[model samples]
Target: MADAPTDITLHQKSKILEVVFEDGATYNLPLEYLRVYSPSAEVRGHGGPMQLVTGKKDVGVEQIDPVGNYAIQLHFDDGHNTGIFSWDTLRELGENYEANWADYLKRLEDAGATREKLWH
Candidate 1:
């Protein structure tokens, strides 16, 4: 696993989360993507079925709280604050962004939903 984030900046205007890892890899992750891909059990179920979060076109992160040296909890504008995103998870999300995004889009299509990505 790569090192944890050395820095994290929230761009409220652009609704982006900029994370710089200790391994020198940085990622500009969308707020919506983070919301949808939250590691919370509410979003990701205990076992089989997972939830399909939707209608988060303009969701923004309200706050970010650090967890015990392993992860960070994101407080989203929609009142979601359970996801504990670890360094490894964040890095994987950055590395596999393209595929994950594509899969998200495909899931939306499969569910007859809209992309609903906020454009600024």
Candidate 2:
């Protein structure tokens, strides 16, 4: 519910994105984490069951660029980066990381997916 980001920086080596908001809130999001949790319909789908994104444990961020003033474009090293994460959405992701991660873990477990295979 805070303001949008004013600046965004990507640390490619560390595979992390640092976003600074106008309200002074900042977030450091990992590439692997972001890839697995992309907001794209290809990842989330339009309705019904959500597509479980696997094999993203070791995916690195290839590029990070601003999309005007509303969102950011992320390119993954694995050649799977068509998702544009919006500022508000990014903030929500940062704020709900723990809960969302837990849910994702549960979903993965239910889908018989493992992070080990994702990295390999």
Candidate 3:
């Protein structure tokens, strides 16, 4: 069976998604992190290299809708609501948060990018 979260809370002020798994593990995922690493084809790419999503340091999740019993669809404040985050995916993100975050930062640096939202 896939790992399931026991509870999920969205702390809007802090822009953090708190996920508590059935196994007693809890992950506090920042909205920016979630947005940049969204599993949607737009970010993950369609059978190609994953896209480097920048300028989302201030992104926030506006809502979360369940997808049956296995996953959830996250509605981001920036109007991105396509990524369906599965239980396994969330678990993996929680488990590898540090490494993943570090890798993301390195990738951004290598590309001469910044997380700061660019003004129009």
Query: Which prediction has the highest lDDT against the true structure?
Result: 3
Q: What is the C-alpha RMSD of each candidate to the true structure, in Å?
A: 3.2, 2.2, 0.8
Candidate lDDT scores, in order, read: 0.88, 0.80, 0.93
Please provide, for model 2 over 65-87, each residue's C-alpha lDDT reduced to its tens digit, 9 standing for 90 to 100: 77887788888887877788987
Q: Taking the tens digit of each residue's C-alpha lDDT, what string does model 3 give over 1-120?
A: 567799999999999999999879999999999999999999999999989999999998878999999999999989999999999989888899999999999999999999999899
* Worst lDDT 10-window in candidate 3: 1-10
Those runs of model 1 whose alpha carbons end farther than 4 Å from true positions after fitting are 117-120
Q: How many pairs collide in each candidate, listed in order? A: 0, 0, 0
TM-score of 1: 0.91
List model 1 lDDT by residue over 16-78, tens digit each.
999998778999999999998998999888886777888787899989999988888999998
Question: Against the hidden true structure, what lDDT does model 2 obtain?
Answer: 0.80
Candidate 2 TM-score, true structure as reference: 0.86
**Top TM-score prediction, candidate number:** 3
Model 3 deviation from the true structure expressed as Cα RMSD, one decimal place: 0.8
